[model samples]
Target: MEWQVWLSIAGITLSTFLARSTLLVAGSRLRLPPRVESALRFAPACALAAIVLPDLAYVQGVLQFDLHNARLLAGVVATVFFALTRSMTGTIGLGMCAYWALRYLAGP
Candidate 1:
């Protein structure tokens, strides 16, 4: 509704597009050193843990821990499965299935 708001939105959209384009162009053309390539391989694992760990530890806007918390148990099982199988798809599918089953079984 306001000119300032429209300008701010345009600025944000332009900045976001530029930032992503820069990364894509640089990442494709530039040859990363071996050390950098090795470190980049761990980025996905670290990012996944950073996102999942907090959810497993919290629920419904409150901190909780008990047998009823299925996410925590499922995460442990998933971690073990990942260690043993080393299959990303299998680990994720098993973890999701385990979480759903536990949640259903633990229903109030």
Candidate 2:
């Protein structure tokens, strides 16, 4: 719609492309130290926790860990599913179902 918007879009696109390309190019030739490689194995789980924990544990700008917090309860159930079955689909489906069931049971 405007020159500034176009420029901003271009800048973001170029930056993203460069950043990802750098990672790909370097990944082909670079060998991480053994210690670093081992540590990197946890990166995915750490990142997932970083993203999901907030939504699971917080509500309306407050931390909620009580029985009324459906998300917390569902997250625990999903974690158990993952631990036992290692199934992503089962985790998500069961977690959402658990959350909805709890929410309904907690009725207004």
Candidate 3:
């Protein structure tokens, strides 16, 4: 609502756009060694794990492992599906469906 807040938002938007676009533009022209290219491929997997690990390990303000925790089970199933199918959208859809089905069958 204030001028400072609006300025801060605009600054952040411009910075983020520049940061991402710079990488996209540079990546096409940049050539790396084979080892570096191979290593860079793991970045996405590590980042995805970092983001997903917390959610899979936590639920309902508490951490517990039980059949009642359908999300954790569904995550495992989804991981296996991803490994086998190597499809992002399919894995996500199947994982979500598994979670909902387990939740429904187990009753809330």
C-alpha TM-scores of all predictions: 0.59, 0.70, 0.60
Model 2: residue 13 alpha-carbon error in angstroms: 3.3
Would you give me the overall lDDT of model 1?
Answer: 0.90
Q: With candidate 1 superimposed using the best TM-score fit, by how many Å does residue 91's alpha carbon deviate from the native?
A: 1.0
Off by over 4 Å in 3: 2-5, 18-41
Score residue 22 of candidate 3 by CA lDDT.
Answer: 80
Model 1 TM-score is: 0.59
Better of 1 and 2 by lDDT: 2
Better of 1 and 2 by TM-score: 2
**Using TM-score as the measure, what is the rank order of every candidate, best first?**
2, 3, 1
Q: Candidate 3 — what's its lDDT?
A: 0.89
Best by lDDT: 2
lDDT of the structure predicted as candidate 2:
0.92
Off by over 4 Å in 1: 1-47
Better of 1 and 3 by lDDT: 1
Backbone steric clashes in candidate 2, count: 0
The residue pairs that clash in candidate 1, if any, are: none
